[model samples]
Target: MTDISVFPNSLQKLVKAFEEPLPNLEAPPGMPRIKLNEVIGKVAYFYEKLRNSIEFQEEHLLRRNAIERILRRKILLENRNLVDARLLINELIRARYLPNDALPDAIVGVVQNYIDRYIALLDHLKLRRTSPDDRRLIRWLISVASADIEERLSPSVREDALVEVMYATIRNNLVLPESIPTGQEQDILVYLAIHRALIKSDDAILRYHLFRWAYPQWQTPDHAVTEQIKSHFQQLVEAIERRINHPLSERLLVICRQYTIPFLVLADVFKERPGEIRELLTSPEALNDASEKAMTKRIKSAGSRLRRTTVRSIIYIFITKMLLALAIELPYEVYVLRLSNFLPLYINAAFHPVLMAFIGMSAIVPGKKNTQLVVQAVQEIVNPSAPRMVFGKKLKPRPRSRFRVWLFNLAYLLTFVVTFGAIIRLLQYLEFNFVSILIFLFFLSVISFFGMRVRQVVKELTILTRRENLLLLLLTFVSLPILRVGQWFSKKIPKINLFIFILDFVIEAPFKIFVEVVEEWFSFLKEKREEIS
Candidate 1:
């Protein structure tokens, strides 16, 4: 009875606590009632708050047309070169599109006059109060613009045509969420679509984009600017509320003020600094102090230890690959006969030089000190003239690994011999003539390909001479086995088929995953090149 009573109260509190970020929390034990309900409630609350916020913002924008007179005057009177009228109209349209809480980076292009005028109003209450008469003027100007010309066409037709043109332009330019941007130019266009959702106070769209980009974890930081931008944003939100209250809708004003502030600040910064806007909006890093970095390194090392013991490593891969080969089960000689028919022809292809280069690289880089030597020596910023590795300092040679490679080759060959020998004895025991020859041959070929590919991957991982080239070759290695052997063995084999099935699946899965990783890596590399150029 006590346990049952305690559970409900505990759950209610849990639901409340879970309102905060779940990933940030620590779990001890036991499920809470609130946690059970939290998943649905958070999502519901997110939409509800966003919806209410939008409706309230729309009401506020209508109320705040008091500045339209000054805006129009500023636009009409300013020289097009010094203060483009297009900029003012665009800024207003953008503010309406971006979220009241978040601003698009495009605001970085607003003219100093508009910025100064708004900032002046912020600092002076008397100036804003005196602005009431201008509303009358603004109303008269709108009336004139809408009035039908005595000698010309009707006002309705002119307005209709303008509306149609704008509609066509919007449709032509708009980007939906699913579209993959082709270049940085598209980032601007996509940002405009994002801003429209923001203008309506849609956190849902914002969160979706965040998830699509893989959020903070996936983004690589350029200047660790996101945190700075985020912090400034929080401060901007607080400041707007303190300043803009009592007249219009507070929620709406708060949203618009916050939404416009970031882009305005960014635009102002870029007006003088020029390319700095990219550094703030796209960069993903949250800057850390030295202590934080040290702690992170320690955590990664600990996690690596867990993965090695609990998650498996090189030894596991070697055993698993061998098991997969063995599951195909064929005679030693027959498998060899089939493979020898194919292996030499393929190995002799131009790919052999590439493979030998990797093998030779593995031999060159052995010790930890020598590994650092090659990396640092490659770049003089890291190593001075006469070349040093590891922080521009002197480098030591890694002891040769040829001996290690020779021993590995010897052990591997002997293992093949012993496995065939065991198969021979098993065949004799069963009086199954030629069974050992057939089975050993099949497994030997399969294992040999798997082994060579695994070793090549290890070589690439351990020796980093040209990572991109290494990546390209890994594709060939991954595809070769699948094309060569995927059709047979697993599909053909019966009885105890699970091992072969699993093995084949694992082999193919890694390559597909690698291709995806390489694609993202190339994208990141391309973006970096843009920054450099």
Candidate 2:
């Protein structure tokens, strides 16, 4: 009964402790709970709390928005240039439709006056507030030219005003959450269409002509500006309502913001069909599906390319290893061993080199859905899940006895040291000369280095299961020593290793150049095909 009662209390404490980020403290035998580890745990708990604090969230939002704003500006400039170029092309098409209905010179002057007047009023406000009278005037101007104009052109026109107001609000040293939704696609498009129509309706003027006709002829004075400027200063009163607020571009914006192939390809598609882009952005699932397909296609193409390279690499490694083995063995046998019978020496020299060649070959061989798995791992930042837990609490393994723990550490250290020493001893025992030792070390380095790399790749793709940890522990004995030797060899040479030297200068450069050239040609053809289609 006492044990059962104690269990519930311990379990409750475990659950409550997990609410903090610190791992639950399980008392070790003959040890107090308030040790160095516990102190660190408490520090970590406070750190986690601080990270999730409101101030931190607001800071993160502001930083992310700042990055986004810079990107937006860049993309907008790029897209604006693209729009301008396309606008020239579009004028030709529009000319065919409205040849006689060109914008008159008088109307052009009037349009410029209205634009200048509005800009002056807007500039005077510094984008803060447009009076009801100014709002009415803007609406009246927008409605003037279109025969089919509704009471509201679209929600975008109002949203544009809000966006500019928010932009001004930020400029005025205000940080507010309302600014986050400033760059709605519709609003941006509406602004772009009107702004460009006004600029580029030189050859074809229907859109601008309608806009000009919409303006009221009454010449209202610039009296509102001075009155508003005075009133704006007068209305500045300190009202301590105790409110809290949070805070927060274009073609260059889109290009800088989106890094994925899916996003880029979809953007290109949208360039041709703006309506579809708007529609897809509105429907989350449809947009996601399109993005997923583009990513899948890209991954598949990369996988296929990797496979072809791997095949060629395997063939090269085999030939290179065989020739290199013959070259290394012939000299060692002739000079050091002084053996008339070269067959045994040849066989012995070939063993390590062959093993190394195969390892190199294996590294390049494509695993099933290897590219997709790698992409998935990257997308998840290689940590797909939380560490395994029991209910709400972490399942801390039973502590190893001190004696056993000491023995394990001792064994691990000894194995690491002894394995390296044994490799050196074995090469000496084989009566290998200086060159043979270098060859053996180089091959050994390859095995160790590539094996460790493979293990790391596997480990990343795998979760930390019991079986995985056990397999990893077993592999460490083989991989860790080799990794050390590889590191040492890499440090000693720094610039040149026989294996990488041959691979890089002889094989890698030429093959890479050829592949890139071929790829470029293929890309060119693909583009042409797309254009034709």
Judging by lDDT against the true structure, name the best candidate.
2
Instruction: Give the range where candidate 1 is weakest over 10 consecutive residues by summed lDDT.
Output: 146-155
lDDT of each: 0.32, 0.37
Error of 1 at 331 (Å): 14
- After superposing candidate 1 on the true structure, give the runs of residues whose Cα lies further than 4 Å from its correct spot: 1-365, 368-370, 377-434, 453-457, 464-533
lDDT of 2 at 8: 27
Stretches of model 2 off by over 4 angstroms after superposition = 1-284, 287-328, 340-413, 422-435, 447-467, 488-533
lDDT of 1 by residue, 448-511 (tens): 3433433332232132234468877755544344334423443354324554334324432343
TM-score of model number 2: 0.31
lDDT (C-alpha) at residue 39 in model 2: 30
